[model samples]
Target: MSGSPAARASNATDHDAEQLRALGYSSNFDRSMSLWENFSLGFTYLSPVVGVYTLFGLCLAAGGPPMFWSYLLIGLGQLLVCLVFGEVVSQFPISGGVYPWARRLVGKRWAWMVGWVYAWALCATIAGVAIGAGPYLAAMLGFAPSSNANIYIALVLILLSTGLNLVGTKLLARVAMFGFLCELVGAILVGGYLLIFERHQQFSVLFDTFDININGSYLPAFLAASLAGLFQYYGFEACGDVAEETPNPGKRIPKAMRMTIYIGGAAAMFACLALILAVPDMAKVIAGEDTDPVSTILANAFGPVGSRLVMAVVMVSFISCVLSLQAAASRLLFAYARDEMIVGSSLLKRLSANQVPSIALIVSGVVPALIVCLGLFMADAVATIVGFAAIGIYVAFQLIVIGALIARAKGWRPSGQYTLGAWGLLVNIAALAYGLGAIVNMVWPRMPDAAWYINYSMILTTVVVMGAGLLYMLLAKPYDKGTAPAGDAWELSRSGSHATGRATSQGFQQAQ
Candidate 1:
């Protein structure tokens, strides 16, 4: 490769091909998603409206008005995580966001575990998000919301999203763009109206944590409040999950990820603050009353018609979120299946005429439906499943972050256009620390009055999911025991070695 124009283009193409070849596949995706479309995918997945509207009441209940600070704190922490992820995705820019990043930075088995947790998380997120939307959907359709009814409605929503995912990327992109607009614009208009025209509490309420009922302890209440940020900031990695379909992925994916967090965080905080500030009775809220502050505030600020209108917009955002999560999950399945990793690899890796992963789509779609159906019987099952979705994604994130720090200690360096460079170590360590702390917060036993198992449900569910993943990897050994790569993609792209013209032949080398 020389300094010629054609040489640069050839080098870039070779880079893409080489990355795929190392992953044991040729290009199979459409790679037709524009920057805005890529941004929309992540934004819709993050879906400020989805996260905020779902957990706002719980967050408000946890710590009263001071919960707004939790969102602020969570945003900063997730920004750090996103920064670390940006550097990783900038280097890999592959499908299966956490899996590929960990695979390359760590090793195959490690990455398999990453994919394991992430895939389940994505599937569960699909279920959790759909079921969470049931009440709004039920209200919209004039159906009495019940556990059984919610299950049926959630399954129907899942079916719609699954079909939407299978249509075509072009159509998917159009819908995602629409969701992005509706969520961002709707959040601004609704929050502004609630804050300005229908304010019940003054701005000083945000600083008041006195009335919060964390058994008279501030730390526990703050930690509980942190759940909002925890749930809201993730799903931005949906950008990196679709990197293969993105043009100029190395440059664009990182930006898309950061934008997803920044923009989504803004919408979530504004809406949450508006609702918090508009609550008229803090003591009643803390006294096990006004359980549905989100819906209550919307209804208070805007009458039934206006609240229903907003609920309708939220419904659209929920469907959009489901569509994005399923799309991302299908890609995870497809990415692993391309290497014959999963149980139905051959089928899952098969592409439809539209160039989408056909069987993977079915797996991603149907599994969540089955999971959400559990809501019909199990007491508090939906609540626990929703908790799983939030914590599961966070666990997947930390796996990659942990792997990055390990790789860094062993001389791994950023090989992409975007990198933290001299500050990479500091950022990675801080992000890792934040992740570990957050994980503890998530797993902490908050339900003191409940049974032991029920109180530790999140920890138990996470363990079961991870245990299943580890067991599958131990038995399946998904990585091909191959030695044909001239040099591993990491080596090819990790430094200037691609230009050195050394070891471009065919010899396999593992990342570790």
Candidate 2:
């Protein structure tokens, strides 16, 4: 603590590494990312432009103007979840996010299931975010936006993002920061223009449902439309996913997580509000006649050339989102493989000269590409695909929340730079309740007249993914092979030292 400023910073990094070692891991990642870069990663993953633009048409059709409120509702709920994650990551500060936190908080088996669900969810999210960019690219290029064309474009984006991700962690952080700036500034400029010069509706219009109702009541459709918000609010957890790569992660990552929710949520709501107020034909959108309301609104607000310029910015945001998602997924794979929990552990755990998970990145891109190919057989199912991704993540999140609750019940108190203290239990409980309710709202079958798979896509996909993981875990017993410490055993030895801001080799060995 009594060194030059540079040496002090180096000592802090050493302390971060020591904390990881105490948790039974030596630092494998580069650990060069700053707090800003880490937050950029989370912000880009939460990409407001990507979320609002992709879901605006669907939400408008399903719940009319009132659907805009979903952003506020879900933002508040996810804030609670983010708080719980902040405390978890601050204490554990490991890579693989929810999985490691669950492992440390509960047991190896429970963490394996969380990792299994989280990995697939991230892959699905990669496909969904990449595919969502296709139509925008098509429109900007003046190409006929057919299923084949969109598929081709989506594949191109996936490959492009994957290549960028494999280059290096520094490049990834730079691109994410650039994308965050571009997307946020573009959203503000475009949304501000629409609100100032192209407003076509009153503020009161948000409360008007335009007579949209389900079963003689509007509550059901409102709940269904909440998917718009639910999808937009996540990706904050990506901050913790790369905890190993960020210096002082136990302190920095939590602040980055909160900033992500605050800035990302506000930007999403601002863009959504401006678009809703500027909609040239709300009735047309709500009636399902205007399938591409976002394009229509932008074209009406800005001329064709200007709209194309804006679409280009949107493309960057989408690619950045894909890049972040791919990085996160590959890290989870690397974490799993490092613990010898997955099938191709030797390969997936290997790091390149750049300290990047090159092979894991390739697998991450491949899985999402496979999911994108499904677009050919099932057209216009982007919403369904993204819905499943949301549910998978939410379910995994709740697993961590439950694990933390159980750990608390057994006398586990967080002793990190970030802790909730007396509010920890209450916040964790609220997060669990909100997560459960959101899962129900998202997984409920709303398309009864459609094909059964289409109607129950989220539920079916979740069950299949989880069911497969369970079968494999039972048959293979991967949890038994894990040699790392788990179930908060480190706390019993190091909790006092952690509170005193001292992590010694003795504490690390004792925890082991």
Candidate 3:
């Protein structure tokens, strides 16, 4: 393997392919996504612009300016989750983020349930982001932000993303990279301008709750407002979702995951802070009068033409987010189908001539579009769907964390390039606790006067998705259809080192 540089590179790729074969899967993806591209995919999925803009108004109205602090809290918690996930993906760089990781760590039935919950969560997220962008899209085009317009615009964005996804993986990576750059720059420029030129509120206003409380307590309001922060911190797991399309995934994917949290979290925090401090009328916004505070803030700070331009940037962030979410969801579907762990395995697993999961991508697009259509019947659809998405994602994540802890108790140790060593247990426990707390906060009934379904949407949606999955697993037993091997594919040595550690290390070095 120690020859010319080109020879070394070829050897590294060959080793990666061999490792996939060892896992009982064929390498059909392009494997052309570089480490930067991988990071970009996760970054754009997190999409600070989209998350902060969409949730800022709702959070402000629910819990006052202090709710912004949830960003830091959720960021720290999600970073711990990212660390545990880094360890898992390093050992098992499977295509689907949570599904294959759960399958290998636990068993078929458990993984199936996790995948089902996660896939629907991704769809809900896709629809949520697209719908969030509708207002901005309407602003850019000088159209009214009505329910029908939002639905139609959301569908258009989904269709556009699916078409881009069908083209190939390289283009996906490039577009993600472009989106990341645009979002980062836009956030910096817009936030910087607002902070320097349009700041009105004192810095101490963040600690002021404005006496917004529910049921003789502000706790519920703050917890409900936590949704804003929780939604911003996910999508880093998208790094692991495209493991098959990435080179040296065991080493690079972990780094990409961590970077996604650090960078994306910082950007989201800065942007949210800028918007919060620069709002033209905080009292009006918190009083539930300024429904679109993002637009209001931008208009006041940047004038009409500049606001529209920034709105266009926001639209890019949304579209990029949808693109990344669709990619992750389709990859999960492809992985499940590849393992024959879902219905319509043969069709969903098929790769086009371009080596992309075209049919699965279409399904991904179609499902989210349908979800967007459902928004037409519901008031505050973005908020409801976002709550559902956040809860489902947390539950799915906890399943993996729980599975890993169970595996560890049975004497399994992570032996990949990234290992938590003796701290794995503590970190895993912390991640699980944080995830569980977030889920509870997300599902807690807050809107007492609203419809029962709206008030309990988060809990209800989780029950429906998980209950449906459980029933399907019991009746269909789709996991029994695949011959794919499960459980740990890599062997550990007497000293607790991976048997393929040398090859993996060399491959990563060659890739470097």
Q: What is the C-alpha RMSD of each candidate to the true structure, in Å?
A: 4.7, 3.1, 2.1
TM-score to true structure, per model: 0.91, 0.95, 0.95
- Tens-digit lDDT track of model 1 for 1-512: 24675555445556555655544457767777888899899999999998888887777777778888877888889889999999888767778788778877777778788888888888888988888888997767666888887788889999999888898777788899999999999999998888888888888888888655566678789888788888888878988888777755777788988898888888888988888888877777776688877767777777778888999999999989999999999989887876566777879888898878878988998999988877767747766766788788888889888888878776677766578889988999999899989989988888778899887988988998999888767876766542222124345455555321222211111110
Which stretches in model 1 have alpha-carbon errors above 4 Å?
A: 1-24, 213-216, 481-512
Least lDDT summed over 10 consecutive residues: which range in candidate 3? 488-497
Candidate 3 C-alpha error for residue 79, in Å: 0.9
lDDT of 3 by residue, 424-501 (tens): 899999999999888877777776799998888888778888998899899988989987766553234334556344
Q: State the local distance difference test value for candidate 2.
A: 0.87
Candidate 2 residue-wise lDDT, 107-203, digit = tens: 9999999999999899889988887787899878877687787778889999999899999889999999999999999999999999999999999
